[model samples]
Structure formats: C-alpha cells, structure tokens
Target: MTSFEELGLSAATLKAIAELGYEEPTPIQARTIRRMLDGADVIAQAQTGTGKTAAFALPIIERLDTRSHHPQALVLTPTRELAVQVAEAFQAYGKYHQIAILPVYGGQPIERQLRALSRGVQVVVGTPGRLLDHIRRGTLALDQVRTVVLDEADEMLDMGFIEDIEAILQETPSERQTALFSATMPQPIVDLARRYLRDPERIIVQTEQMTVPQIRQVYYEVGGRDKFEVLARVLDYESPSSAIIFCRTKSEVDALGQRLTARAFPAETLHGDMTQVQRDRVMARFRSGQAELLVATDVAARGLDVEHVSHVINYDIPLDPEIYVHRIGRTGRAGRSGTAITLVTPRERRLLKLIERSTGAPIQRLRVPTIADVIARRRESFKETLRETIAAGGLEPYVSIAEDLGEEYSPTDLAAAAFKLLLGEPPEDAEDLLAEQEPDTTEEEGGRRPRRRREQSFGPERGMTRLYLDVGRNDGVRPADIVGAIANEANIPGRAVGAIELFEHFSFVEVPSNLAERVVRALKRTTIRGRPIAPSLARPRRATGGARSGERR
Candidate 1:
C-alpha cells in the first residue's frame, strides 16, 4: 500500500498517522496490517525495527471494543523493556480510539498494576511472567480478549518463556485472532504457532530488503573516551541537515544529548524513561528543525517516520546486527540519499565485522576528521555563504564598510580578516587529532613500544579535580570502563573526563571541578568490573622517581 489511506483506516487513525509523520506503510506493515484487520491469524517473520509493532498495533486498535474495557487485546513480549515500548506504541497509535492500555512488568510495583487492572484497560502489554501472575491473582480476565499478539516470539522462546506463553494463550479465547512476530522462527516457535494459531497468514520480510541501499555506510575506529570528540568532528565535517544519533542505552542518550547541546549542536533526547508529553515535545523540536540532532535509544526511536533525516549516526554500535540495520534504516527514506556512520572502539572491531558479514555489505572504514579538515570545511562553508550573500545583491552596506577599510588595507587582506573573524579559533591540542592514527612501534626491553601513547598523569587538568576509586587494574577495570561508568552513571560527557591513572588496586580519574563531588556520589552507588566502588576525593601521594609500583601504562 502506498499510503495508510489505502489501508481502510478510520479518519482519526489517518490523522494520527499523519501527525506521527508516517508517509507510507513499510513492507511488513503493508502485508500484515490488512490480514490482521480482516481478523485473520498472522505469522510474520520480521525483525525488530521493521515496523512490525505498528503492523499489529494499528489493526488491534481499529478492531478494539473500547466500550467494554475488559482487555480486548493482550500483547506478550519477552522483556519488560520491550513490553513498555510496545505498550507505548499502542498508546500512541490508539490515542484517537480512546482506549486504555496497561503495561505490566515484574520490576515495577505489583500493587500499581493491580489497581490499573482493576480500573479496566482495553489492552494489556506485558511480559509473560507478570501477565501470568495477574491471571493467577484473578485480577486479569482474558475471556473478552479478541486479539493476542506474541511479539518477538523467538526471543520469548529463547528466554524460556514458552511455557508461560502457552499458559497465557490457553487463558485467552481460542477463537481470538492470533499474530506471531519473530525475527527467526525456530522449530519451537513454529510448533507453538501451529498449535495455537488457526490457519495463519504467513508473511516473511526478506533479509535483503531489511537494509536500505541508498545509505552510504562507514565506520571510524575510535577509543571510547575519544568517541565524543570524534563524533563532534564527524558532525562538523558531514554537516548533516538533520540527524538521529543512536546510543546503546538511555543513560548514554541523555549524556550524549547534553554534550551535543553544550557544544552547540542543538540536540534532543528520546528514551523510554521520558513521559509521553516529553517525548512529543522532543519529537516536535526534532521534526520542526528546531533541533538538528536526536540522541535516542532503539526502542524510543522505533516507528519514527521523519523523512528529512539526512544522516543516522551510531554513537554506540549496537550489539545486534539486526539493530544496526534498523538504526541505519531510519535514514535513506523517501528516495533521499543518507549516510550511516558508526564509531567502533578497538574491542568492538569484531562486532563491526560481524555486522558487515551479516548485512552482506562492506562498511568502509575512514579516518576521523582532523582539526585541519574541520577548519578547511568551515572555510569552504563560509565562502559558500559569502557567494550566496553576494548573489542576493544586498551587500551595499557591507561594501561601504569595506570601502572605508579599503584605504587602510588591501581588499584580499580585508576579506581574509573577515573570514578569520567569522570562523572562530581552531581546536587546540593538535596531538589529540593524531591519536587515532596507526601507532608506530619501536623495539623495547619487553617487546615493542607504541610511539603515540596516551600520557599517564596522576594530577588532574587545570579545570578538573582528581577522584580516586577503590577498584582498578587488579579488579579488571579498563580506562574505557571507567569513562563509561562515570559518563553513564553521573550523566556527564565522556569527553569531560580528564586523565585516568590505573594502579594495581586502585585508580584515579579526573572530572570538572564542579562535577567532582557529583561523580563521586554517583560512583559510590555503582560498580566497576562487577565490584562495588568506593569513590572519594584523591589524597596526596608521595612523588616517585619513575613509574609507580604496579601502575598500568
């Protein structure tokens, strides 16, 4: 179907889809939604981020009897994270239908769920365990359920929730329209579907169609701490008109969003933790060009159909290859060319190769943009702006000022000074730009020494304060681990972290003086290398002549 209008959806639903920026139905959505609305059992073999949620959700909402409010639909997921995400999708798509949707998961308080169930929700999206618990407590009734959806069925089978799923299905009416969605339909899933669904309509979205060919894929190998810096440089070089930056976790999204905003990138964040209103506001800002970059987690960015996105950046490479495909699929839509850039750490190169192998496409590796490259790009952009302004023929006032200065200086010199004034100072620390270059090896006593090694200093930088941690090299902690923990837990930018010095039983890390205490407090409640940490202000240590005993280089 070219448009949702052809799907026979109500006007209200079409309005909601329009406001959500959905231009057309995805392949999976196009094939599955019609059968679902026709009350046919469907078995769709599609991966996550394939618009599968909407494929089932839209039909469920259209067929729901909201007046009864006795759980007309039940959507089962393997993880609470996905349960919440799917529930949110139902809410977003069904908002016009005026139906109540409840998401029940184990980690949340049961009493709250009990009360919500008592209040009556038309749809219940939940993990099998919690849904079973509610069913056993006699608080949830599935007799009125007209639709049942098993989302990520293979994952549920992998998680050993197959029995719970069977039990939940047994509780629902056997005549209900059943829909099963899975990335891979293993034998168990197939058997379960055969036994539960009645003559299901099968739809398999091919692997070749999962990735968009219009996207130019590339990756840059960067250290974890240097990722933020590399990303900033890449953004400067690419200068995408609009971009969505995918982070692995919500905490990463928030931290990266803050860092991008601090650097004047005009970024917004979307994650599961934000309220619906907050998400709406963020999406509005992103779609309207008020925000140029959207730092988001996978679940939060799903079902988003904004067509103007010129780039999709994987700030943190996804662990799952399918997820990588989905992340990049956000761009290169509506017949527009797009770019997908990823930052890979040394340890993550294996994962990058795995993704390439799975996608059957080679991801070109490119060097991180140097400070000089960014400066040159800035100069070129300034020249383009100058040309445009001159073409507009509104330079009379500026010409008079140039004429006044022409007597004192040459025109070329005057233009050069103007260019310098407009383009601010170039980045300091040219040495840092060479950090990603292949290290030169030299013969040493042990074996070989890297010529371009990161400096190890115990003292903090001028604006930073040093903090000590109880766990270190002995606890199997690496510099990247330290940076990730601090950035994720403290909500600080990884680039803000200063020098890190690792010792046998301890380590010292630096943060901005203003955030030192906050980092310490946040670290106190967190763990590194599976061991709890005791973080505090670093105490003075005696100066040593050479490398400290048991210190890691």
Candidate 2:
C-alpha cells in the first residue's frame, strides 16, 4: 500500500516514476527501497515478476551524482537480455535527472562499450562474462562505484558465473554497498553473501504459493515430431487474445516464432541474442496487442510483466520443475483468469508430476483437439464477429449492394458466398490436427493393468518397438516412474518413450527401435521407485488377445 513518494525518493525520481504510470510500490520495492537509500547492504529474495528492478534502480538512480559520472552504480545480471532490461528501467526512471546509463554485454562490439565507458556514464549494467572481460582489460573502472547489485543471483550461479562474479566484485572498492536478489537462496549464494556482504539486512518475502489458483493448468500427452502440429491445433481451437509461448532455447524460440509467423500467427521472438533495440520493439508490439503471441526463452522473459496475456503455453517442458511455475506465472495476473497449457511427451509426464507437487495444484489432462474442432471454433468465432457487426448497425451502406446481389441470386446463396470470402477456405482434411490415441488397456482389480498370461515377444509399432522390464505394478511401479528413469538415465528425449502397460508382475514399454537398446542398458542400472529395474527385449507372444506390434496400446 506504500507509494513511491513515501519511499524517500528524490523529486526527480518521483516525477519520472509518475510519468511511467507507477502509482504504488510493490512489496519488494517497498521493503528494499528505503534501506537501499540508507546505504545498507541488503539481500532480498523475491520471484521473477515482482518489482525488484524498480526497488534497486530507484534508490541507485536517486543517489547518483550525475555531475561526477564514472559508473556510480553497477548491476550484474546473468544474461545479456536482463542487462539491457535493467539498464532501460534505470533510464526510464531517471529521465528527469541528467543521468546516463550504459549496458555492456556479450554479442555487442566491445569497442562500443569502450567508447561508452570513455564517455563516463553514471551507471553500468552488464552480464558477468563481459563485465569481467572489461575489468581484466582495465577498461571499466570500479573505483567510483559506490553501489553494486547482483540481480538473479541464483541464475548466475547456476550458469557457472560464480568465479566471474567474484573476480569482478574483487576489483570493486571494499566499501561499496552490495545488494543481492534471488528467487531462492541456495547454499552457494548464502556462502557468497556471508563472505562478501557486510552484515546484509536480509529481506525474505514469503510466497503464499508458487502458482495462481486462477490459472487453469492442462497438459496434452504428445510425441516430439507431432508437437508443432498439435500446437497449431491448440492455438486455433483456443484462439487466445494474447499469449506467451515459452520455449527452452533461443534457437527454438526463433524457429518456432518464424514457423508460427509463416502459419499466419502473429508471433514475435524474444531472446538473449537479439539486440537491445530489437528487444524493445518486440516488447512494444506485444504490449500494444499488435502481436498475438510472444515466443521467448526463460532468460529473455525473466522480468516480463504483461497483464493482458490470456494464455501461456510451455512449448518445451522445463528440465527444472521450478521453472514451470515461472513460465505459467506470466499469465493470470491482476485476478484475471488465464489458461496454461503444457505439451508433455509420454516420458515427460514424470516431470509434470514434479511440477504439480511443487506448485500444490493438480494439472488436468487435456485431449488434443481435432481439425474439426478447430474448424468449428473458427466458424463460431466468425459468426460472433458478424453478430457484433450487425448489432453495431454498420451495414447500412452494404445493404444496397447485398440487395442488388439478392436480385440476381437467392439471399442464402449470396450469404454463403460472403461467408466463404470472410472465412477463407476451410481445410478439408482433419487428419493433421487429430493426434494418434493409444488404445485403452483394461485394468484388473485395484486399478492394475491385467497381466498377459502367455509367453509373448515384444510387439512392433510404427516409430516404436516394445521392450520388457523385470518390474511391474506390484513393484510399486507406474508408467511415469519407468519413463522418468529411462529418459533421465539414457539422456534421451522423453517423447521417444511411448505406450507403457504395467502388469502385476512385469511391464512392457514402447520406445523408438533405435533407442531400445540404449534405454534397456540405462534401465539395467537404474532404479524406479527405489526398485532396481532391468529391461530386455521381449519376443512377440501369439496370445489370443495380444495387442498388435505396430498399433499403440
């Protein structure tokens, strides 16, 4: 409930904040701003979308003496994308003051950074590697830096930037005020704070829960190759007003964005490789509703806060379960309901379970929509658009033309013609949108799959081959446990693992034929649900009701 004006910010800082349309300080901002202004070293823990940037930026900018500019404040981020974002925030908040901020990061010409450094900027925001490079070359002087901030400290440590961070910090003045912010305080981060930070005031923001209850979480089991086709169908069926699709890598973001664009989806890519200006323009388009979707990696979308986003799609299931929460948190803001959909390959279902446990929410299993469903949704959407237009009474001029056409042809025929023009050509075939469904196997008592009685060999399936495992339902084993062990131990894509049938004494799993041996070898030494599992090739049995090798069961 605190206002920025009450945070003891300078008049210039207050004016700039007001111009930026920020009326109140967020929890992190309210707690850390005043202490930072008081020149205290603070260690703050907060989530990604919280207003941590303004918390540190406002105080650092307010304390800057623009007249003696030589990097008075330095901010180190884990990625180049974050560096640019933080630098831009500083500039926007300090617009009324005569302050200059420079962002130095990789992918940009070092000479440009050197030129900016020679001009003596008041603030320098940079990534660890490039900042350390500047430090080693004696280009970026830290003698005048009175405040040093480490943003997303945990991410930097995860990326193996601890040594570079230490090297850069060692070059700074010993008396400089230090602030570290991270979502979680891991042991290494704690050790770093203990050794370097001088009696830091710890501010721990206790999160009620990792996920927003208003967000509807759903997952669709899909194969790796069929993912894009399924994603296209989902978008068409849902038709989100505005959405952000989270991908795992920058290359994936770019490729998927381009593909979506080719398919007539208004998508823009955001990642670390983009220039600062490109990133700004992409964000502008997204915020203005010109772009319907934003495809981005986790690092690029870290501090993004877009309230109008109605949907969030996780194109790639995150290896780290905690990241799932952050990806879905991009939506369902300001008490508005939103949808979060994740496409999980069969093997990745185990990862989804971990995320559900972390977020304390049950994610519903969603069936993939067929091509007919997309077409039906489109028709309904078009009808609604026509109804709204008719209600608005904007057809007065068009009525005469319609009447003339009606004289030559029946009204129904003319209307049908118009509909075709408006809706374009509907795809005739629905096979592309329809995902292949696995056959339902009957379960015995206590919900266990009935075991096959006869000795049979593993069945063959299209793009899959069945393997036999020595453990089954009686061994406290489930499909996900088996899939997780194979996927993790073999270092293979979860999508490569297919249908799994758990019986009382043993189980059968379908995997890509090329990877069957690898999976078997990996599972031999792996444990599922604490029980050691040894997988081997199973011969096809000529049992009376045995599932065919090529078909999913």
| Best candidate, TM-score | 1
Provide backbone clash counts, one per model. Answer: 0, 11
Candidate 2 per-residue lDDT, tens place, 196-305, comes to 89999999876555554568999887766567666876887899989999886676887687556534477889987789999999999899888888998877887898
TM-score of each: 0.48, 0.46
Number of clashing residue pairs, candidate 2 = 11
The TM-score of candidate 2 is 0.46
Q: Compared with the true structure, what per-residue lDDT tens digits does model 1 show for residues 426-524?
A: 334445544534332111222222222221123436767777676767789999999999999999999989888786566777789778768977997
Q: After superposition, how far is residue 179 of candidate 1 from its true place, in Å?
A: 1.8
- Look at candidate 2 and tell me the lDDT of residue 30: 95
- Runs of candidate 2 with Cα error greater than 4 angstroms are 209-553
- Number of clashes found in candidate 1: 0
